[model samples]
Target: MPGKVVCRDEWLAARKELLDKEKAAVRAAAAFKEQLRNDFPMVKLDKAYTFEDPKGKYTLAGLFQGRKQLIVYHFMLGPDDEAGCSGCSFLTDNLPSSLTHLYAADTTFVLVSRAPVAKIEQYKKRMGWDFPWYSSFGTEFNWDFNVSLDKDVKSPVVYNYKEMEKPFKGELPGLSVFYKEGNDLFHTYSTYARGLDGLLVTNQLLDLTPLGRQDVPWKRHDEYDSKDLKAN
Candidate 1:
């Protein structure tokens, strides 16, 4: 079925009427969600999980970089994989420019992956991204956060607040937020799978188009072909 075609005036009137309801619903839902997020109880973190960066090793606390809040993108780049996941790369490609704004709001953003620092750095360079990235290569950080699965494990793996009967062998994507109060650190929130959709600017923008997302498959920003690049 095709959409109804109407004159400019009629379309304008209908759009305006829909906009009124849309605005009210959006505002109400946003306010309720904001209150729920703000009121969410935080768990105190006492584990001393260490991560490796190009410069040196840092504990979870050091990843905050003196900021009161920290946001870590759990990038799905396993140690044995040749490259990072295309979806994860797309997310990070949109992150560099937002770093300064997040910093101003007292938050530090970083990418964490199970891949070695060298592999992560190489991929970061290939993508031409300058954001901070760290490796949890030999640490329990990824497992603790439920983003990694052991290859030899026979049981189901838990992800996104549920157990998967068959899980991916390696890394998965997620986002975890933490807060620092003096010397104490707390886990404020963590989201996985579709929960990370809020960070995807491309999807958000495409939603405004007449064709919506066009059922297109996502590629890493650097991997798009000439035709796709030109179209974009």
Candidate 2:
């Protein structure tokens, strides 16, 4: 059924009433959730995980690049993947412009993947992204972070804080936060699955429009057809 159409004055009156409730709910929910996130305990990293950057190799602490805070996006680009995950690429397409703001806030953002540095670089160049990306190939970083699943394992794999009965093989997307204090580094938080919805500005903007997200599978920004782009 179609929504009822109302006169301008009537629509304004109804919208204003709903806006008041929306504001109240947003304020209360945001405040409480922020507190919970801030209050979560941090875990000190003991193992020395190394990653391959464009220049050379770097330890996990080096990823911070002198910043007190670091945000790592676990991009789903396995060793055999010809291209990065479409959803991960979609999220990354919206990240380049935010680099300056994140730096100003004393935070460094980077993407980590299990693919080789050469493969990562090729895909990054193909996508025309300048954000820092590193390859965690031959390292336990992805496994320890719960982003990569082992196919040969006989038991259930733990992901998103629960044991998944049928775990996905290969790579999965996630976001992990780390805090650096002098020489010490701590894993502050990690979010997987829909928990990463907060980072998708495109979805947020679409939610404000009439058609919303349209429930279509996202493609890499460059892969979208001209007609499909116009329709959405």
Candidate 3:
């Protein structure tokens, strides 16, 4: 149903009331984000995890790329999968192309998946994405981060800090932040589920519309049908 139509004065009064709540919500969000930066506990990483790119192999520290911090998106592309996850692709679709700002802030952003370098490169080419993507094949990095689940390898599956029944095979999406100090790397923070909503610019835009995302099914950017592309 459409919203009830009202006079300009009444509409302005209602909008102003909402504006006050929006301002309060923004302030609360800022305070929580500040807490994440300063109060979150850090875990020192001792494992010598390795990943591969189109060029060659690189260690965890190498991913920092002279930056003091690294942001890794645990892309849900398993070894047997032919393509990336729709949700992960949606998130990447909204990522900024130029990282000069992140670089200036001493942070490097990259994506990691269990797919091999060849597969990663192929899909990246198809999607026309230029972001750095690394293959975590033959590494326990996915398991360690709880993004890839295996019934045999790990008991009592846990994801997003909740216990789940052991499934034969599964891959989930998540983001992890690491801080580098000299040669030491620390796992600063990680988020999953709705914690990632803030990163999707499309959803933010839709929220301002009458339909508000509509729980729409995600499609790889290039896969949207002509009918779906048409304006409603």
Model 1 lDDT per residue over 1-232, tens place = 3368899999999999989998998999899789757777899999889899889999999999999999999999999999999989888866657588899999999999999999999998998888899999888899988899775772567889888867567778999999999999999889999998878888888977777888788898777789886653
Question: Could you tally the backbone clashes for each prediction?
Answer: 0, 0, 0
**Pairs of residues clashing in candidate 2:** none
Residue pairs clashing, model 3? none
Give a tens-digit lDDT track for model 3, residues 1-232.
Answer: 6588899999999999999999999999999989998897899999999999989999999999999999999999999999999999999998987888999999999999999999999999999999999999999999999899987778788899888854646899999999999889999999998988999999999999877999899999999999999887
Candidates in order, TM-scores: namely: 0.92, 0.93, 0.96
> What stretches of model 2 exceed 4 Å from their correct place?
96-98
48-128 per-residue lDDT for model 2 (tens digits): 999997799999999998899999999999999999999999888767575888999999999999999999999999998
TM-score of 3: 0.96
Q: Which scores higher on lDDT, 1 or 2?
A: 2
lDDT of each: 0.88, 0.90, 0.93
Worst 10 residues of 3 by lDDT: 161-170
Query: lDDT (0-100) at residue 197 of candidate 3?
Result: 91
